[model samples]
Target: MAKRQPKLVLAPAQGIPFNLLVLSQSNVRRVKNGVTIDDLAVDIERRGLLQGLSVRPLLDAGGQDTGTFHVPAGGRRFRALEILVKRNRLAPDAVIPCVVKPADGDVSAEEDSYAENAFREPLHPLDEFRGMQQLVDQGGKIEDVAARFHVTPAVVRQRLKLACVSPVLHEIYAADGMTLEQLMAFTVSDDHARQEQVWELIQSHHNQSAHFIRARLNESTVPARDPRALFVGIDTYVAGGGCVVRDLFEEDRGGWLQDAALLDRLVLEKLGAEADRIRAEGWKWVEAAIDLPYGYHHGLRPIEATHTPPTEAKLAEVATLQAEAEALENEWSGADEIPDEIDARVNALDERIAELAGGSWNYDPAEMAMAGVFVTIERNGELSVDPGWVRAEDEPVVESEPHGEGEGAQREDGVDGDHRQPGLAPESGEDEVQTEEEDEGIKPLPDRLISELTAERTLALQDAIAGNPQVAFAAVLHNLVLATFYYGRAESCLMVTLTKVGFGFQPSGMKDSPAAVAIEARHAMWKERLPESDRDLWDALQMLDANEQAELFAHCAAYSVNALYEVAPKYDNGRISAHTVERRLVHSHVLARAVGLDMVASGWKPTADNFFGKVTKARIIAAVTEGKGGETAALIDHLKKPDMAREAERLMDGAGWLPEPLRTPELPAQADLLEAPATSELPAFLAEPDVSGDEEPMAIAAE
Candidate 1:
């Protein structure tokens, strides 16, 4: 028999030693049977032992001090202390405090150890799976994740594999009965692509006993090729395919069987006959139905036999029938039924026509008389009325005094013939101003004369600009400015005036004179007013070389129609000389400088030559064309240089000033220069008056 170990009693202390009883006593034995002392050491290292080892006092046979404690459990802790002492990490003589609980009546150490480990550090498969999956979700390697969680990489891989599984299966796994190893095996061969086969197999095996399922699985490593194979020898087929077929097919077998048996006979005989009959008679029936009104009773009639051989007689009969049917249709055209509303409308129209004819005899009589005249002319080919009764003949013809041989009624041998009235001619040295009363009592100007005049001016301006190169540029620029400022009326009016002035000066040979220059300057000012987004304006601006742009800006700034208005008072006294007008140019220059500043501030590039060149070009063009002589081609060609062509085209097209080819003549090269003499006299108009009241009234001699 093995001898029993003695026990020892130790007093509890207020302060516990970090290492007590590190050395193992002689009676102490190491833990055995699959328990490692290192585990207890690990536990103590993680959570220091709250309750120390319990032991009982031991007595020798003679009552001597035999130092040994009978430790029921915590033999592992005692062994760990012994190992720590051997390693010199713990003191060999230090005593550790402990609660001495009874081992026999209280809970066993095994149960206590289990309770402590279970509550203190429980293991959960789902928690482990979640932690591992989290690492994988965050881009961590499977191996690293497994290492971090102290799990096998394959286990982590399997858990991550669940991500691809159906939610239903995931729920099943979460129910806790499933093992990872089992789930992995189930999923390994289960390809979602083959789901149809797998599902069918599953359905076949559902409600089957476990033994049956196992047998099926064993019989086929792969799922069944035909899922129905799994259901063979199973009573489920009777409830499934058989029952469904029986329910659907049992009652309807007769028709189906008949159809199958007599298909050829029906198609060849009955179907063929019916199709032929329909083709022949269907058209006739359709025609009859269309001819008859809805709900009208047409007695039942048998269809006539179809004629196989066509003949003229048959065609004639068909035509006769068609004509008869058409006659019947014509007879029914509101003949038997006249709606009250339609009748009332017809009567109303007739009444209105009669009333109109009855109330106004003038138009009717005129029409009837004209018609009678036409009939008479057609019958006799001439009117035999008395000349005195003819109003046109009865009207008096006034005679004028005959003038010089060539001016008076001469031989009617001229190209246009003598359109002069008989015995009417201006006297020698006398200008003929035909009085309106002599003609037909001078026709009064119509009420819309002003409006017509304005329209004519606008049309004339457009025509002048379109036909003349010089006017085109100014016109386009003015219009652009007008559109920008929303001052259409002023712009249009100015355009008309400019065109007229241009026309008047063209014949006078002042086309390229100071007046023309001033007009061009005004146009440039107008161009400056164009909105920034206007494509034509931008193109025009871009066409200017740096210096030219600056010059244009400077010229426009120095000279403005508005500025002229401001300075007009200085010249209002009248008789202001050319010298005075020239002096005002200095003020114009100052205004130009101010304009330049504004232009620069508005983000327009400052260029002297560009500003002056544009003004110069516009003035020269306007002067040369003078709203005549068809100078648009030369101007457009000159302006068609790459920089200005697109903008010039847009302006010309938008303004409807594009001239048709060959409609007008080309301008002479000296046209602009010819205008200088007339324009040189402009300063006289700007001269101040002799306000001292000594000015003489200009006299005019009457012819």
Candidate 2:
């Protein structure tokens, strides 16, 4: 019962006159997809039709030959030829290559058109990408390809970049293993091996975020905005044979310098040269570092030195420049926008004035022999050299006054090198001295009096702590671990713990405070380094080495420190005892002294917003009096509270003033064992958030 073989009818190819070919409405293609008719016409005109059209012979009702043909398929091609003929590029009766089909059969014109339009598969995107890449590889300019394909040069370049991705990743992308965005990110770094490595690393964590990928790829690179990179110009870096990897798909801040080692070397070389240049000033020693950490000059004495005033010629030049600037400002004050030339002139004048007015400090010859200079990079990538810092070890020994048992004995409870009676105080503008009231042990003082005294000690302690961030970090972390792991049952005495460390609740101006900004940046950095999934975090942290772990621990622990003071609620809670709060205060003071935390050195300056506005009018006036003297304080004392606060803030600017909370509390030298033990172990209970009221939820601002 085998079926008879079905006869196959194939379309016939033949040369047809363009004038005889007419478009048929029976064609199935209605919507346009690719290769517009005009483009097709141009393509056909350039290189005669490579594909033939399907056409049906014209016929009458009686099936008589009509001598005219209608095209059922390739209508676009027919129009292309017709356009050529009309343009006189081809004769009216010019021949066109097309496939002819029978007009009266099972295969009708509609069927033929439908088959031609529906059955063909479009080129795959990868194939197209590869095709464009091939054109480029064959020495075809991107512009030429773009013009030929009716696309932009950027499009052409993007296609090429996609095509150039590592073949392994391409295969994975084809299988839908990675997204197009992730693929684009890999193009930022062209190192194929490195790309593959990154892919492998992210596969385990299932993190293919574009930013994460780019960050991992550029982990060892320095951003162009980095001070070192800015100091060493990008062009200079490139000219020095250093490489820079640029992101084509996003704003990468002028790209990243791939050669970090080279940048470091250049920075060092430049800093060294600057040190040498400054050495001619007769400084005993010129210390150079990329960055002078907060409180770097602590424990050192600064010798008083006068700045060398500008010369007469320089002063005259500055005056002339200032005059020019004032004139320019006056001329442009009413204008909506100043002309570029005028603006440039004004800027140049200002720069000249700054150059002439600014000069280096000059130390005496003897002072210079004992003092040294610190050379570091400014935030704006400029060289900064601070002179006249005399190390304690370099200071001349001073003779001590002879004393009996109690006449001028050193205070064992005071800070190192500090010698004063327990209750003794020196008069303003006078040398430190012991008071006779301190002959007997001190009596109990009023709470207000105690607070005032503690406040002063707090400021000094804070100043000392500004130099020891690591020790402070360790101390805070040690306390947090106990409270976290032991919960209510924790036997630890440390009361420090971290609450929410976000700045979302801050006043608008406080958002950009230096401390807040620094904390935010540090948190963001650590956030990016940590794995997305909590499960993977342990492993990710485990991978870090001892130094890296210490750094991470310090950064994490810093958020837990809460040294601010607030009146406790009236409700007596056994959990938050006054005694416990007192202990925390004592511990914080001890920690401050241990770390040498100095608010002034940490760059905190009293202002209306952070200081005066948050405290009483008396406090503001007192701060002004202490920092700027009684005359300055009196000027603002009669104003309304708000006005007085503003005036006081201005007067206290750069006066190294601090509030009671921010000031380091006074603790004896014997109380300096505030550092907590450093351990890498994470307790099982500490892995989860404390939910048993173990940690009091206080309004602690990490800033």
Candidate 3:
């Protein structure tokens, strides 16, 4: 195997003489006279130099030893050392051990030197661009130059492009510290002038933040150049690069352009559907109008006809005949009864009178005149006439005319008086008028009842009950009792109102009996069916006082109790078993303690006849006994003196004064001597053999 080459070493700073290191490359040509050794010195002092020179031994043609080495890199560092030395600074003598690679094949030293100068400190873009230009000028392919610095050719082009960009844009780009990527995105145009314009745009906005730059770019009004113009054969603008077109479309369609094409299409489809709906609705209205009854197409129109006046002979004959009929009707109206002579004349003239009248003489003018005269008629059916009648001094006499019996000879003129009689029958229009009048007279009862119930009387009652809670409670009780007993339809409405009032205010009465009753009534009404137990409970409720009833039926309600308890009391009047009452009292006591009400005095007093008395006596007995056999002895010990005992004895004596059956004796002594004896087994009682059996066998045969 080949041995590994020795690794290159670097010089250390400590314990080394400072005057021996070579400072510069004698062979390398200088490009600028302004470049000085002091520049290198300043750089070194500011940032302590981290890298050393790479150099090789220099030889003359004679192959003799020469003291100089050709610098492969670090020319700047060597110059910096020279400056320090001239300024009386001690220089290190350490040989910065280097790999003597062939200089012709290696470009890393140049690239690294440039990179250190460009990046180790911030270099202005102009300076970097100049550096890149020099590198490309020095027989370096742009790619190779770019690759050596670990940058893309595009990036390198941007730096060079920066040289051509407007100074304004360059300053702007530099001020904002924009990335090359951002600048490339902005520089689509190859024209230096256009690129300069864009640069000016970019620079003018340097004072703007990144967000503002993006907004301006988004807002730029310049129309997008044809994609083919921008890039050969390109058919479309590059993604996300189009200028917003604010005025490209009509205002109504402007919003459509803002959305994605697909969304816009969907919106347009919806708009089309809506338009179709509107058109359909419009057409429906048109169709309906066309089909409507009493519409223009179906409406009535006025009729036009020529008029002719009646002949003068006919008018004179009608006037003469009307006057004759009026004279005859006046004569008939004045008569108490139509006289036989006048009746015959009136009947004969009736046909002629009807013909003279336009259509009918069946319409008696006398009847119409009588209707007017009867305006003063009293509702009691008494006819009245105007007293200021003008009486004729001499009445015109009506001539009697004989009737011609032959119908054909009445007139050759086609005249029928009977047709006129039909019009005189009282008009059917009066029937319709009377019907409308009747409907106007009647109203619905429920509406009236509701109105009456809500009147001031009801309101005042409600207010009074509300102000005096006791009245509200009594009202609730009253309503519940009514509901339970009647089971009427209105019971529910009444109970509901009472319950609302009951709950609205606290009961000021002894108990919430009314509230309980209302609750029970509601429950009974709402339940599937009334249970017998509920009926019994109702009966039990009535015997109880308000407090007892309230307490007993509070869960179910006293309405049921009141209904039943009014008839029966013993079982339903909240008279629970002593044990149950005791349990309830104990529970109440426990609850009171738990809720911090234990210290409150119960204010309970007991008498022998009452439930409380029994409970109290039982409690006292239990306490005194306490599983001890000295309860009486305890009581005796508790009464300290003989006189006090005598007083107690007297009270006991008085209690004993009642009938023997009614009196209760003192409790038995603790140590009374009435021990029960142990039961003994008597030899099974043997019955003596009956002599009647003559001699029963006394022993069994041996078996």
Candidate 4:
């Protein structure tokens, strides 16, 4: 400072004619990078070159000034201006903004260029989003902003979607508390409260993966791919005032409908209208249901219907379609693979041909008088109208009530109340036209879905009875009392009965469960003490004390606990429609509750292979989120399903997690544990940008 800083002389700011400014070799940006020359030119043309080029005077050996200038830094800018001059948009002699430097070696053109290129830091995504949001808030059209920024409107839309997420989430995202992918998932739902709720729910969970976040956000809503939503078209759903939350960042498959009940209502209304229209075609009764039970036609009669024959015009159309199909098949038969367009065309044609070939069915009025129609949605969201079903009560009554005393009842001729549907022969058995799966409709609960439930349930029920002799005494007393006092109505309960449901059908790992081990040990102990022969069983049992007899009785009675859930028969499909099954579930749960059947205490804990692996990734995340906090659940959300399941199993161990079937009606004390943590209304960045637009900004930054 004492030396008086050398009188500083800086580069002169001046304008050079476009023709005089030539790009210099010292520009270090050799590799092609962000912002194409064309785009830069457009931006310059639109905004008129915001930055000046760094240039040096071209001089002779004497270091004298020449007319032309050489640009070093801002090579892109120079090229953009040059482009305008070439396109005749700007005159060749147009003055371009630039900083003129001396010909001296005080500063190298390469140094200037390197400084410009090397010092540039890409704008943060959040900053970009904020700027874009600012432009939008200023009433700038999305397209206009995109054009100005040299980005697509879709890109603008995706950035803008970030605004829809809760401010708490935005702050978390800014702090790197959540990943960009997870934030993207939150954009599907615009509800600030819901977004925050989901965040809190996941923050404590081990699995906060993007997929899990999306699933959690869409829990209460129906996905666009759902059968109900698909049955009711998106456009139609929107027209009905239903809100669809679309994810701009991910493949949302369309989006989720926020109003699931509304979609269901629409589907029901549409189905009802179709049912009414079908009923007008002449039928005894018509019903519209969202899901018709599996084997709904059981014990019911069916009538045959004839479809309208094809006319000459229809036949010609069919011939045309068939010819097209054959031509396509021949053309692509030798190819390694057909293009998607060609394949789609072939499939479309096949479907059309099948539709045309099936024609329309005309039912007989006589059969229609007794038969009913049921309209339901098919799995693929297509309309499925099942007609020609006659209920037992609706069947025609044969006057077989003994024409004389000597004449036997209807059963004498191998014909009872079972009346054959009109227009059909006796050989056509019930559900004969249905596939095995269709007939079974939900037969044997989906293997993996209930595998854990079934396995754990059997163990819990058996172990509970074995441990609780008091409940066993009462259960036995209840059964014996009903048999003695209630005569034929001996069917008192689904649980604690004499009937032994085989364990062969139970899922794997059941034999390895604690209850199974304990039962095996107890049975082995009894076997060692008792006589092996059936003849000596009574004497061997009689030799035991009262307590031993009670323990053995409880063990034997425990085998009757069939807590497994199988779809009850809609009608009597052989087994006496235990329609009592639901009541049995209730009664058994009551008995289990009486025995203080705490599944957790009974040693039933969810594991990867038993529970998590058997369920969807979403379920695993949900269970983790439930047992552990959402933050804990969020920890594993990003993992692949198998990995997530394994991790979830680890986190959930000793967490006392129970699947729906294993749980009783009463919820634990932690039901309200999913509430969101207290958070500021908006992030500082978003709020600070607008002082007068809304509320205080420092409320959060202060913390």
Q: Which candidate ranks first by TM-score, i.e. highest?
A: 4
In the range 1-703, model 4's lDDT, one tens digit per residue, is 4776788777688878888878898888898888899989888887787888888888767878778888888988888887888898899998888888876767788998899888889877777788899999999999999888878999999999986578788788889887888888888888899888778766656567898788767767888887788788999999999999888987779888999778988998999889889888889899888876443454455677877977778778988999999999999999998999999999999998887877777888998999998788876789988788878788677684352221122445554223333344545553353244355454333223355588889788878987997656655644532322222133444353355454434555454467767877886676567553334444555566778767776765675677665554434556633344555666677788778788898888888767888898888888898899998988888877866776787788888888877877653256444553453232121122435866543311110
TM-score of each: 0.20, 0.54, 0.17, 0.55
In order, what lDDT does every prediction score? Answer: 0.40, 0.72, 0.41, 0.74
Give all candidate RMSDs, comma-separated. Answer: 37.3, 22.6, 44.3, 21.7
Error of 2 at 279 (Å): 2.3
Span of ten consecutive residues with least summed lDDT in model 1:
372-381
- Ranked candidates (lDDT, high to low): 4, 2, 3, 1
Instruction: Compose the digit string of candidate 1's lDDT tens values, residues 1-703.
Output: 9998888664443323434322324222333644467755545555566667655333467755355434444556767766676767667665665544342435654554445434645446555556667778899998877655456786677666545444454456688544454344333323444322332344432222332222222322312222222212123333333211111111312111112113223223433443345434223121111011221111121111222444466556555655554555565576878667655655555555444333321223222221211000111112111100112222235698653343233445431112233345534433233342335564434324445688889888778767896456444444434333332324244433211101211212232344444656665575455443433554555565667655544444322232221243323355443345454544554555654523223322212222213444454344234432334534443542332332233223322221221022233369776765653332333445656677674422221
Report model 4's TM-score to 2 decimal places: 0.55
The sequence of per-residue lDDT tens digits that candidate 3 reaches over residues 278-383 is 3342221111110111111111111112234555666677678777767988877866888687777766666665554443222233322211110121222122
Q: Which predicted model would earn the best lDDT?
A: 4
Candidate 2 displacement at residue 319 in angstroms: 7.2
Candidate 4: which stretches are off by over 4 Å? 1-11, 136-148, 175-177, 306-361, 400-703
Whole-model lDDT, candidate 2? 0.72
